[model samples]
Target: MARAEVREVVFRIRWRWVRLSAGVGAALGGLLLLWGYPQVQAVLVRSSSLRAEDVEATLARAPLLPSSTRAHLGVRYLYDPAIFDPPRALEHLRRAVRESPFDYRNWMHLGQGYEAVGDRARAEAAYRQAIAWAPEYFLPRWLYANFLLKHGERERALEAFARAARAHPEAAANIAELLQNEERVAQLARLVPEADVRARLCAFLLSRGALSAAVSLWRDLDWNEKAKLGLARIMIARGISTEHYALARALWCALGRRLSERAACSDDLVWNGGFELAPLREMVPALSLSTLGVSEEFAVPDRDFDWQIENEAGVMTRIAREEPYQGERALRIEFTRHENVRFSGVAQFVLLRPAATYEVCFAYKAEVRGDPRVVVEIVGARRGVPEENAVLFRWSLPREAGRAGWTLVREVFRTTPETSLALLRIRRVPADALADFVKGRLWFDAFSIHPIEDGVRPAEGEAL
Candidate 1:
């Protein structure tokens, strides 16, 4: 019995040793594999490139591999594309994405692989899978759209482009521009139509001065407030009447229709009468009001109806941002020096009726209202006799310093029986005021010229 027990103990010890040896052998083998994997992968560069036992170790080395198959796919996409193997690359990419279902790039690369292998069905399915995984991602949708387009799947490609537009509209617009297919772009726009998208497109077109194109898109963005306002500003800058733009006119009329006396002042015969329009010149010839059949002009040397600095050598004329009587801006006339005490001020060419007694009115304030030589008159184009001692300047009253109060000035005169144009003039008449020169700024606003019944002379410079 003792001998039997000894043999059993020996057997038990031998079995334990064997099991321990097996465990140690496995540990050593695992360590060797871990250490030699990179070397083996390097050695299997081409022959067993994708099938080597150590090839998968390459993926394991990159921790982000499972999360994004892009690096693995990039390995297959060499600087020399001729060496790429789409089918072999796709096998590993599919396995990685199956392990990480949330990976968008994995699905995307799988789709690209399927496309390279000419499997259109699988390619489209893979692209859709990528989109489904990351609905807000632009790259997948953009790639999908491009892939479908490359395969001549036009309808599905448009749908994919629409998806891209929905994801990142500006990027989609860039692609649309690249496509240069106007009709297709229009159709794509209709499919995913967002007002902001339309507005952005319109704004881009308009910024490039693509007016007709912008006009075509305007109807779609008509109700968008920002777009409408931007278009209105563009129209205003063009200096053409709002009538040229039906949308702009609609906006203008909409604002007016909300108020009483909507039509009373809707049609002002003056162009930039309130001194609000830009390039602040004398009356521009592109006057929207064509009642008198005046062929308007623009940005030229005609100060016909614009307030002018008669003595530009001695005075300066500018539109001021100071306190305006009615609008945000007013006309500023600064007299720098005395050209023999006859300094220049402001003037306008008034278009009036034949045999008409009209009221010419405007607001003015002087830093120092000087000599009656400064007069305002409606004189004919043909000067028969200079009307000396005219009450044009005899009528202005002065005010305290630093006060913004304006003195209203007006005068009435009869139009010549055959006169269609008259000079609405303001100047420092040749008078004897011993200030040496007319120095100081005078602001004017709310200029209006209209005929009254019974030829009553309108009072000038009535303080408001």
Candidate 2:
């Protein structure tokens, strides 16, 4: 053999070895990459907060992720200001919807993406598709309604808003805002057919200063309807806060008349004046005279014309049956302990003609101990009236009347010029010593208040 031939063979062998080593190294590197990629992907997946770039990189690497995941990532890219790319988001959301056409959220997001790109027609179509997929769901309806509203499609937007509000009554406030802005309160009855929804709409109107509309809607609702829907007390409160006194008066009188209690619309302005009605402790979902006897959680009070009684310490109030001055029922107040309590528990708000004279008359029988000096006080309750000048009239109950028969007490008083609202309360003037603390029971009945007309005869006592 020649030496040159041997050298050439060794060179060819070295070249083959070098190529083999390179192939082995390449295969090992590919195996390592395949093993570690999932760990890196999982880290990104488990991240507490992810940037738009991170989401984009993740979508690029993991194409086999769920369609919902891809749609969510599209939302991130579409909304994130740092990397807001509507076209890229539209692509991702479109692909997601293509993969899972039944996903309403993907359709909704696609609509938003189309909206971002100023594609109104496609955006509206996508939103309608979402609604078709989930007609009963509120989100799609609300979003679609808002989209219609943004495009100045007023009538279509109102229809959509009504559908959304009907599906979820809590969304009625949104419709109320729209209606208020458009001055479309007259269409509320047609828009919301449900009575409960009307109540909510009325309250919203009142809160938003649509006083005339709220009052009009309230007037159309009957007493039974308001009672069934629990709107009587709610509207009364809203009326007082909004200074809609006529509405408040009408609600109180209507409820009182339905129960056959002592409420009147003609001459008498005081409600339940004869103590024939029980003060409601709470406004239940469904309310009536029969339901008021049961004790429940004390919530908001009927602050209109009904007697607003408070649970005072050491004082118990109820209707007594022992004595009959006018009817079988009489308001009875009993003091259990010797405490110098400033008792103002029994009260009612009465509407009166400003600067007009009226007579307040009542029958009471007392068996009280000590000289607590309970008085019937009529005070001006105008919002900014000073406490010192609030008292319009004061009549003291006999301090020493022990087990006395029914005494008819009468007092004539004139309302202040600025006072159309007055507080008529039975108060026990707080004494300096516990020795003057009142004990025992007092019974009252046949309370009445009426305007004093010209040439009216001044009676010595009132007949209960």
Candidate 3:
């Protein structure tokens, strides 16, 4: 062979050997990857489960994981006080955010981590970033609002809180807890002016006894929204209980105008006196008048104007539609106790003028086996006076030998100088022995109160 041909043959042989070696190396690498991929994924899956042992294993196995895994681990270390490492948690969270910049939750975690370290500026930046990423989310906005509020950025914080509450109304309760003072509450009210949100905030204030804030919020609501869902009634009832008689009256009259019921805002002072309007007890299924037949469902009236029937154990009261004294319904009270029991189960709250004369009238018929006489009385409520001293007027029913059909009972009396509010109540007159506690039924209807013109005293009337 020629020399050139021999060199060419040698080069070809070397090149072929080199190519074969490279091919073998590539195949081995591929096989190793196929064998190891599932194990790596398995470790990651186990770590993601967040169990203590699995997390430890994954931590030892792989130093670099996905953003979500890092975020999870970050949360664990950030919140778990036993293993809490703020620095390490921040490191993990920062890595997670770097790995997946689009994940808003990762940003939120990062913000919280920064906040925990007292890096207010960085924390705010991170929170804003998270909110920018997920504008519709509630938590980020809520957290940002809290951060701002903590830093005394009241206006900005209120705006952020309003946004959060608009997104999720449940946030109102949390905001309420945060803004305990009246100023902050007013600021929040201004920011979130929607009636529903205001209503929720008002309810929270009422529950917390933030009287001024509650009253202010109630005034902000339009007449229609105030009447919605019986919120006005609740506010009035709270006012009466808290000795805010003026506020109660204002709410009652405003709501009456909204409802277009002249009688509600009229001078009668007794709402639903004829028992014509369905009381709250007759509204709900569980607390309805129908349930009174099966079980004695007891609850006070939610509205100040509605009758607040006393929840005495042996007394059951319900609204009866048949044979009402004047209207479609009357209160039917039955006493089942066999022993002497002090009973005052039917009542209504009314606002009255101090030192003014008023007449209370009602019609009733009773069939009694025992001499359980019922008495009507007007007693000053929230007066901090002795029971006897608070009694502005009292009338006892004349004993009935026969079942007298519907009969009228009326009385006139002047109030004490300080009596601005009173309760029109029917109480059982306890007789010696079991006479007053005998099982008997009574029907009451056409209860009414009118300011006595010229302050004239009416002749004492007989009761059935």
Candidate 4:
């Protein structure tokens, strides 16, 4: 062996090591390319690709592997902006569905994702799939109706509501409310005559607790006898008063001749049989007419017995005086200010029965002021009464010049078992302390009280 031979061998060994290192580096580069291609594709699909750092950060916060790790990962990806490329999100959701096809929640989320991306047709298809998976599920129907409403397909929306109502009668009220709130109904009504819109409107109104409006609309519509009878039935179910029933009766009589002519001889037979009237009597109970007496001189100015004040400017007119029956002097105070004031009063009335709910109504006018305030104070021995005057209602009206005529303000109060005499007071706050109470004139009108039906009242023969 020689020194030159040793040097050559050493050089060859080093060359071999370099060749091996290069080959390993190339293989590692290929592996990296394979790993990065999907992420690159994701970026192409949606400009924002889920970054590795984000995925790592999320995984760091989430509970590590579990039996349902894949599903949780899917949800995380679906919600994570870095991981949630639209296409990737959809893929995750699809995987979630495949893993749990019977899961209504998964399908619902899938549908919601599609809807969020504005793929309505696909979203609808997904909703239908969810319904098919769980026919008894109420949420899918509600979602489907929402889709129909968004697409401006109102008839379809109504049909969906009908299905939802039938499936969940308890939700009938909610469905009806949705229908009534839909703007399309009004739009549709404009396209057709009032008669065509009547049934739908009645159904909508009845569902939304607009019983009075529905009954009024029903009476004016050209419904057939059976339909009219059904309307009356619903009205009775809705607790329409005798006054409303009397109005309905009058309208029925007025339409009697025309109804008979439309129905021909068969219609005449039904009308003569009094089948319609039979249900009216059976479903609607008669209300007893009762008169309520007050100490002050008050007149029922409207059908609802609204009271009014005549001479507001005349301060000589005693707003407070004793009534003939109970000897309770009524005090009336006129407000002439731009700002709201706090006024207090105590009522002296002998309650024939305790525990009755009473409605209190007052009329006031707002004059030109920056911000006019109105407050009502009811002080009585009722339990749970506030230490300060109990504020039943508060209103702020825009201060404009002159008087805005009379506006009715009302509140319903429940009287306690121990309540005897109640007090009512109206107060107006001046718009500004520096500004005089000019043009703040509020006309104090007639004040009246009525007991609420079905409200708790003292037993008969009980004295206040």
TM per model?
0.49, 0.79, 0.70, 0.33
Best by lDDT: 3
Number of backbone-clashing residue pairs for each candidate, in the order shown: 12, 0, 0, 24
List, residue by residue over 1-464, the lDDT tens digit for candidate 4.
66654443343368888999999999999999998677545433332334534443443453232213334444555577655655555665676677778877677767877876789988888888888887776788888888888889878776665555445544543554565553543433333343433455555555445556666667666655344544444444343222243333334444443434432222111122211111223323332111111111221111110011233332222334322112233333444422334433322211213576666554444344344454555555232123245333233443552454545555566666655434343444444556534333343433445565664543321111
> In terms of TM-score, how similar is model 4 to the real structure?
0.33
Give a tens-digit lDDT track for model 1, residues 275-322.
Answer: 665533221223231111112332112222334444466567777899
Q: Where is model 1 poorest over a 10-residue stretch in terms of lDDT?
A: 287-296
Ranking by lDDT: 3, 2, 1, 4
Q: Summarize candidate 2's per-residue lDDT along 307-388 as a digit string, tens digits.
A: 8777587788877677768867888888876667667888877877788889888888888887758888888765312255
RMSD per model, one decimal: 12.7, 10.5, 8.3, 22.6
Q: Distance (Å) between predicted and true CA of 58, model 4?
A: 9.4
lDDT of 3 at 405: 80
Candidate 1, RMSD to the unseen true structure: 12.7
From the highest TM-score down, the ranking of the candidates is 2, 3, 1, 4
Tens digits of per-residue lDDT, candidate 3, 245-268, equal 787777766655555453356667
